[model samples]
Target chain A: MNAGRPTGTRLHWWWVVGAAVVLVAAIIAGVMIGAVRLSPSQVVGSMLDRLPFVDLDTGLTVRQEAIVWQIRMPRVILAVVVGSMLSAAGAAYQGVFRNPLADPYLLGAGAGAGLGATLAIAYGPNTGDWLVDPIPLAAFAGALIGVSFAYLLGYTVRSGRTSVTLILAGVAVAAFLTALQTFIQQRESETLREVYGWILGSLNTAGWAEVRLVAPYVVVGLGVVFAGRRLLDVLSVGDTDASTLGVRPGRIRLVIVIFATLGTAAVVAVTGLIGFVGIIVPHTVRLLTSASYRVIVPLSILLGGAFLVLADIIARTAVAPAEIPIGVVTAIFGAPFFAMILRTSKAVVS
Target chain B: MSTVRFEKVSVDYGAGPVVSDVSLGAIAGEWLAIVGPNGAGKSSLLRTAVAAVEFTGSVMVDGRLTTTLTDKERARLVAYVSQRPRYPQGMAVFDYVLLGRTPYMGTLASESTHDIALVWEALSALRLEAFASRDVATLSGGETQRVSLARVIAQRAAILVLDEATASLDVSAQHEVLEVIDALRSSHNITVVSAIHDLTAAAQFCNSVAIMDRGLLVNHGAPVDVLTESVLQEVFDPSIRVLEVNGDPVIVSLRSEEAYQ
Candidate 1:
């Protein structure tokens, strides 16, 4: 019954190229196949025209240009950042906890971010002011605070301060924060539309401002996670064994959690809680490829970007002028795809 | 040319000490088996060598105190096998064995060619060349034990600690596993400290024995000198006997009914 590509000798070189191609293809599809369609040459010439020292007029109207650059490009880039962070964070969580089912939000960061966004919307002095959008910043702070509280509670209640206790602490923290958020959301009935839209999650309102806000965190966080790939692999053997191998298990877990939560909070501030991408993309990579974090982590970054862009395509197009929440779209498309992978690809996942 | 010495060693899991005031030593190039009934703290005592568990008192490796050694430095001296080592799902046998090279690798760098070469050497030594690419989850229990040993071999540690590593294997597989370990032990002049429940196997395979009871070290010496019928009866409640087979003393416990007679 054990049938899979020997995960040890991962088909490393070829899949790196393969994921690149998939990303390129997914990016192309994301750019080209939107509602107000532009021809391939027009899109290419427009992109080329924007580059310095390469000014050529591929006749495009101001409106189409706005549609391409202002609307589509920012959404796609945000998708890339959010998707990459969630997937990589998910991989790190699973490795540190040594549990395959672990997800990025296992530490209550997402719920904390959700509460932060709600508070900014409900209680901030200028709810109507778009010039200084406090939601993203507040959400980032709340996420870190939330995880800190969970870590503290886990440390206090746990006799040994094990990984499982941390997960349980996250669950307890998430429930409390979500309840508090719901209470506030209900009281602030005036901004219900904004609150609902934010909670449901959407990239339709994405702009260069939102992308600019989260880009640096995404870049730095992913870099730290990449550097920690081998250590994460060692951690898969569990914390005690990892310490025996000379790396401090507690320190590594803290560093990874801190950096990953930073990136995840940044994205959640803008995108809300885009659920399934964090948990599913890494798992899909594992089932199709290898259990080694070396393979899974990098692939998660690539494929997560691709998967979200594809899901966004459906989210925007499925019912024209009535946008579906990006979070819901991820599950609708991802769940069945994951099931198919589980059935057809008999890789030893656990 | 190394010796592992434990002095006034005591391990407590907050409730009480599992291994209390146990002074033990294993000379270089020797196999020392720790034996006792369940809850005798044999595993806890063995775990002290690898620093896997927290313990009071001092453990010294080749005259260097354990507390003074860094984690990687201690790893280079000791390799440990659990009662049941986990084979991560879908991990190839080669990858699991390659984990042994973690101590030698820098944080950012992957395995070097030399690290890979040692993995191959260890695999071939254990006759696991063909299984290198196979999924570790697919291996039989005996093969899994051997794979763990191969990983330890790749580590190239001077001291080996096994906590009933072959407890789940069949009778023939147990003997085979012990023989392979002994062969590697003598060839490389490695020191071994194992906790085994099988008294006969411990007597037959180990150069010396240490008997523990209720977290205390009760006896320590050569197997023949320490495993006498009278000595064992004092520790074990049941009727026990020492039999002579090819001049080796083998310990066995009789049934309750036979004990009364």
Candidate 2:
């Protein structure tokens, strides 16, 4: 393991090119191979003619047009956003903890969002603002609370300020909060079903409003983490080294934890707790690319977004007329894919 | 200029005191070596002096109290190189050495060409020019020690603290490293405080030796005066024949009482 250069390295630029190609192929597959198999030529011609820059018609508008634009486009966009957010958050969390096992879920972001969304479902619909979209707002609030609680708990302890301690505390908090949510759900039948469904995670109901709500938080959170990439590098060395290297590990960790949790919370608040995109996607990308934050951060974002869009396509078309929980589909596919990656790839210190 | 003075310093690592009421001073360009047996608190004293470990009492460096100064300022004045640092796998040897310059770098500023050049110079001084591009993880024990030395050299700090820095290396590598350190002291006038395990190496290299036993300073004097048969017997529980070679002391440990006494 002690080598001058990292072992079995993959060139980062190559991965970017490959990811771009895969993304394009996935998009085409997503559009053309739905319940109704549209011809590839027609699909391409229609896409080109309908382009805002070049207005040429490939024929057929009404029903076909609505299906492509309103139905398919929004879902695709949501998938991309959720995917990118999870992947970026995963990468950030892993960097901060300096452990490969750390993902968005490890720090209570997922459970907290679930708890937040559950509370909102229990209380929000009665507030008389159908325009307000309680699920996203309440889930956002829950996510913020969960993340802040984890940070506060970790920060408060003097000797237990390690990333390991933070994760353990988060797990405890998640368990307690999940139990409380369940107890609250038991009190009402209608809300119990909502809670059950929310915990399982779904992206079907996500719309433009949900998308708009998460966009700003995601952008700001990503920006904050990106700015602190250097600090993350210092942190990879132990705390003592980080201090000697002119970085205040305590403050840097606090900021990173906040930004990462916020992004995870925002995405989970809107789309529930989608798994694997955060944990699996970043690892796959890292295996293909360099561990350099300058490359990994942006690549994970793009690749994650693309992965989610592709996954969403599978979710929608796999069982037409009725959709499976997006979480189930991601877990089902991600488990084997992740295992394969592990089997083929050299061990990364998790 | 680094003027390190510890006044009645005491270091306690939880259970009890490891170093108690120890007072010492090392001026700029002075090299002071602390030589002692195992569990003598030599490492603790050095760590406490650099403020890497907590200690009670006053430590003054360049006229400012160590406790009062920020970590960054303290790091600028003193650089500590621990024996056999556990480097991250795949970290380049050059990059590991360049970490010495971390205190000088800005939060966002990438390692500049000047920093890299200095790192290279440090590597070259240690005769590790060919290993610059190699990973630190792949290095042998001797090579790793030299890499750690290069980092401290690149640090270019006024005061250098090494905790048994050459213990892990072979005799030849030890001499090679000590020679480089000797050159640094003469040319740059950098003050060095090292905890050396080999008594002969200490006697040959260090101008002044501070011997410790059971967390207390036993003797502080020139190696010729401090290193004696009775002192060795009392401290080490073994009798050694002290020989005078060209007016310098050479310690020869007796295999048994009949062999020399």
Candidate 3:
């Protein structure tokens, strides 16, 4: 065999560092530029004082501390966690399906969550308890059911299970569930506003509780996805090719879909339906680096978190006292970027 | 040094068996070609050796039953190259070839320097060094075919199972690919079993040829013996003439009666 020069192995430390720096800057900007504007020093000082063994006196008053710590910090952290989860899920979905256009919501997760939240608003007991947040709980259950149904439908349609058939099944299930959600809204028109608000997606109601609720799922799910990154690359080579390489494409795809769905459903349950973060972040990472999932998955988490935090800042401050849905801002920017990607890259879309 | 053996192997995809009781072998460092008309179960028989389809009886690689081996162990012993392999968008040719190291690397571990060196060697041997950075999606038909072979080369397996590996290549590219495989077979003492449609190419390259018809292996011997005019006419149902040019058989198809004036 002819021995050529060793090819360059990817060194993505720069990409990781760049994304982390941007995330830190976005967090600082998110905390400082809210309605009750706090200076950069105040934000840093308050944060440092909260750290263990660092009780440095902050120049801010008690009300300002509450606004910074209680209000903005939790929202910023929730944005980071939820954004990372959604974008990572999107990357995994695209890899598993072997389709560039696939997103976290490709398998009826969005429609299922919508129906769940709608049902909660229409018939669930009216309560103000954070522990018993019926909307999120129902939405989580609904998302799981929706995906399960899609998988079953895909399985039944043919003896051999292919990704194309599964995606088509997901589209069918999403359409059916979406119609049912709309019908429920029509029956109880009073719940229309609440359902529409949740579907539109927002970070306005973010709190420390939401952050704590989603952090564990995001961490565990991301760990599974990160470990399977190389396998994802193997899988992108098609089932027959992957099999010849000693990889079980069916088993790996199932594991990836389960973990990605769990993380996506948990976050979508809480954050409603945030669009474009999953597709946009992963696509941007692919454009900058190679299409190896090893780089795409991790970078998506870091860059996605930063992207959502920045979008949230605009969502709240773009029209002070009245917030635009976080989804709207992402779609506004992401749609155009997605169009540009399609126009510029001649790579295989499938 | 590995030899592939199939004894009474049968495969079925719900609608009865597509390949039945087919037995064959490719000794170490030799090339075996299976030639047949379409729907003659040639591809299915090839797939049976790799465990890609559910099959009965036994397929032995180097005297060990393939069914008894784990997927990784089997992959280490044998590598498969499909006729048309899928390529991911934006995947560099280097990365695509490096995937052949999958059986050797741990689940979570990335490719090491040694693994990457093997990939570079395979690419260079195939004259694919210039296309290393190019996207697999952007490769020409012949180049894509070579890249597929390069991936199998990177696997470093002792035996190769190829299904119509050069069906899409032009005559010149076909000869180049076969020459590369010939060189590798001699250097590495590797065994190759290919299912090809080109009878002339098979007679030129392979030491042995197996003819199949209606899911059964009908004949197996030296290429000159098995690729006779009668066998080709019977199996392929084509009116063809086999001529010996410099001791090599060259197949020529005659026009049908309806087309003749």
The lDDT for every candidate, in the order shown, is: 0.86, 0.76, 0.88
By summed lDDT, the worst window of 10 consecutive residues in model 3 chain A runs over: A1-10
Error of 2 at A36 (Å): 5.7
Clashes by residue pair, model 1: none
lDDT of 1 at A186: 92
- Residue pairs clashing, model 3: none
Error of 3 at B203 (Å): 0.4
Q: Between the candidate structures 1 and 3, which one is better when assessed by lDDT?
A: 3
Off by over 4 Å in 3: A1-11, A48-58, A129-131, A340-350
Cα-based lDDT at residue A301, candidate 2? 80
Q: How far is candidate 2 from the true structure (C-alpha RMSD, Å)?
A: 4.6
CAPRI tier for the interface of model 3: medium
lDDT of 1 by residue, B1-261 (tens): 888999999999988999999999999999999999899999888878878789999999989998898888888888888888878888889998999888888888898778888888888889998898888888999999999999889888999989998899999999999999999999889999999988899989999999999999999999999998987998886489899899898788777885568
Q: Considering summed lDDT, which 10 consecutive residues are worst modelled in model 2 chain B?
A: B83-92
